[model samples]
Target: MKTTAKILNGLLILFLLVSCEKDELESTDPNLLNSANSEASENFNNGMIKSYSSDVVIQWNELLSQSIDNRLPQPAEVKIYVMVTLAMHDALNNVVPKYETYALDNSEVDASDITKKNIHTIADAAVSKAARDMMAQVFPPSTATADALLNSILSNIEDSDLKTRGIAIGQEATAAILQKRSGDFPLAFAGYPLYTEPGEYRSDFMPWAMANPPVWPANAVYAPNLGSLTPFGIESGDQFRDQAPFPLNSADYIKDYNEVKMLGCTSCPARTEEQTEIGAFYIENTSSFNNRVARALIVQKKLDGWEAARLIGLIEMSQMDSYIASFDGKYHFNLWRPITAVRLGDSDGIDETTGDASWTPTFTTPPTPEYPSTHSYNGGAAAAVFRAYFNTDHCDLDLISPYNLPGTTRHLSSFSQMARDNALSRIYIGYHFRNAIVVGERQGGELGKYVFENNLREIKKLK
Candidate 1:
């Protein structure tokens, strides 16, 4: 009797572990649940059905570029990505059962009657309404333009009971998310005090080298305090901050200095024609490029609307967290950009380190202090999310840059390759050290893991 009781207890413990392990699991099986609605899900995944969420994202990408072109800062751009995607995911999650919604609590939104609704009609109305509404709030100046575009899209959807119900679901999701993010205004920390230290970022614009271009005469627009913004899944901004960059006079610093000097200079002899092109290809802003990549890959893989929505939402949330974490490292370490470091190299008292008084990067440096490159971090987070959602690193896909490289379409063998190229682009363009790229990639990958493990996982149906 004692032995039998012990056996039963052990089995109970094992069952609990298996059931609760969803948080740590990276991949979701397509057939994880077998329900009476299995055929509908299969249809959605196999491209027999259209995906409304995918359409909304592709269209929003265009408007997002316009906002950035009008000089929306990087942090603001990323926030735009997060809210729209989150709203879309929450809106459609009522009819689907795979992942948990981000801002909308299940108890708050009634999904009881939604199970019987057509996934296509529901996803269409919900994704469209949520995206249209969020854009109006985030980009007020473009609200009129956005509303017209949204109405044009909606006019195509025929009137039906399903459409009415779908629109309501979307509106509910929008209200919930908007209420949750109301305090997350972009200017929340606009006038926060800027930090400065021995090697920290400063606004003094002095020429580095005689041959280099003149210092940007205008005052630098200080990056907003992105570190304080609310994260979708992570507890705090500093949760994933990377360690500080290598010390100023270390050998590690010297090696990093020499490599960028040879390959990243405005007139670098070591940078090949193709390397320059790669750098320019990723010149598209962080939020826009990654979102474009995800959309392209989704079409290539033929994933349905719901699957595409989840993947995009997951990727954007991971990236937003990455940006916050990267900013924490940037402001915390207060490191110098390569342009500053290379120009001031002589003063550092390192015998091997030489200063190029005329040194300039291929492009102007961003205003923020440098440690981990934001572009690399975004790419790393994007790659991690794509790999986890697809359950493989080896996704054969072609990425056609919106920036029109010599060949618009760059064929890729895997998501990791795309990430590798994105990191190397910073070095090729002469803005970052190799260490920054490597560390940023690692930081992003870890953040991706945290997002997947902690948020959004397939749960058992209410069977």
Candidate 2:
């Protein structure tokens, strides 16, 4: 009896350790999709079916990382979807006539006349096409799905600033440019420019990158593998494990220094006060997590065909618009994070504090100004969108993150609590201030409200 009991207890312990951890995600059965199908949900379901065809989730995350680096943010594929749906919705909202046009240039309205709303239309069309192209790229033409894709995009847009502002301008612009006899707005806008010169945006990165490119310190132990089977460069798999359990590319001290390699050292740098703050901001936000548990989670409601596309498109537009606003504020305040300010306590001429020679940030510092936490705003906007879809922010769900971690999963009963948790994680990870996170959360909630309410002038409120 004693021998049997010991074996059973050992077996139970092993089972407990392995069973609760998730590995492969179970694929949802197409035949067994959502069962509680109201008209709106049915609409969402149809769009989700369309969306399911594409691998938008993966691509979208990858695209967002190109600018601001973080474990979470809005996906690009959804953003494009919202752009398209907003275009269709904007078309419906066009109630104005031509003569109210403000000419952007005297250059000539020859074959094609340009207007703001028309330009917006052109961008939306481009987004849809890009999304479709990406979808087709992944699945063969016949397998490309739009059901989930549409629902996801619509949910985002219906709750985002992009749909509201883009559509706001689109509605007014559509009416103004549709004056009597020109397809000019539609035509000219199909390829209207949305980007400013790289010179302008790169100021934030150019100096940072120039001073830092890929480098190897004199004390490094890496050596090239002569064999073709191995990567010509870095060690792979278990060989590099003992020194560091995570990826060499994982956010680390050296990686932090490399971020501002482009910018030269200051010889009494004229902007000591400004540069140090920005440097500190960079140092604080650039950490990378392969996997980390998240308190807030995402719940996607399915919408169908045209409406799904439009609604999901609105969600993305809302996020993008919020980001633009957020980005604008980042540039506006030009503030510094606590890490840098705290570290350089003596340099700033403050006598009360001392720099910790061994101090390090918990996570990587993202490369942007810090005022409003993007994570907070994005989380709040997303939470509201989900609530709008469900008509309540009370769904209990688990969020399994793809931050490259082996097993990052979190669960919550209500969407709002999850949003709060996601916002609070910044403090847990120590990258943002409580004030910034709260402000971001407040702004995001407002942004979500503005996005949904903006579309309701023509109909009864959805929720």
Candidate 3:
């Protein structure tokens, strides 16, 4: 029965791939299998074929982003990406001998004694298998899509032994990562309570403002339980947590309120066309934007499989830790969003804060407690990691929005430039105050610094 089920599952997966890949199948690119051309190519497939490790990472990252966007929260999206990418890194590391393994949860597989194997074939099989299995666990409904990718990856390997070993290694890595993530952690979305006082996050707002689905529970003293998850390199989720938002009714608070009110409204005349473009470009969710930029940088540098693997692993782990730290601050303070403050300005006890009852944001407000914007945090985290990796803030990097423009790439002079723009973008879209973006950048920078200095560093290893 098990064998028959396997056969039937394989057939179903094939049918789904054919149905979904009508256009992709039309491309007759044979070089897809041997796409890498680095110093590492000399040792690949008995010196006959090159490895495509970086391409594998890019493809899998794109697929995973699409799958998670279909159904999952930000926390889960971060978690699954970390797992699948780390598995790919560890699997390739065993063959390349460049860095120390991340030491996944239940991983006990050993390949030290194996010899005369194709690292390219092994990497391809391992990455696809690890991604397929992990996605099955996180998004069971996405099995058809996941299986199609797996079939496509495996069908390209010509060597039987390399393919078999690659599958085995990938499976072992997935098990280890799953074991590491197993335990009590906050993975579900449940509501808490709302603060109904005059100055707090107002659950009761005008019909238009509150029409879209509430971030659920309307208002919770504590946000989602992201703090419960394990940190990558930080000692705790609150390790980088900072002070609360500016004191309500302070001069600083009044200045920030007026700035956002003038520039961040749906009908603000002060906002420029360039500012509006920046806002729209960054409107993409964190996972998609960060991953897309990271992939573009990796390809531009022509990093080999193991080099790309290690860089991607570090980037994702820092991002995950930064998010945890940001959420800790968000729930601890439970600050109101700009929309809430703008609508309730009259009651905030500030002489300068005149209430605008009919005010709307330039874009829809995200469903979460305000203060210490996660988008800003994500930007800072990614920038810091890139800066650390290149050993300079002056590296040339450009990010084009997948959602906003297909041909227009925004040229960033430095990683810091990108970070600063991302921090300020919330105001352009009327989603965050200046204080939240500023503090979120600090928290994320600290998290990124900690991860960069402490973990996934290069070590002396024999090839």
Q: Best by TM-score, which number? A: 3
- Screening candidate 3 with a backbone cut-off below 3 angstroms (N, C-alpha, C), the clashing residue pairs are 105-180, 193-219
**Cα lDDT computed for each candidate against the true fold:** 0.73, 0.38, 0.73
Q: Count the backbone clashes (under 3 Å) in each candidate.
A: 3, 68, 2
Each prediction's TM-score against the native? 0.80, 0.43, 0.81
For residues 429-463, what per-residue lDDT tens digits would candidate 3 score against the true structure? 88888988998887788788778777766543222
Candidate with maximal lDDT? 3
lDDT of 2 by residue, 163-182 (tens): 44433443443233223213
| Candidates 1 and 2, the one with greater lDDT | 1
What are the per-model C-alpha RMSD values against the true structure?
Answer: 11.1, 25.0, 17.8
Ranked by lDDT, top first: 3, 1, 2
lDDT of 1 at 444: 86
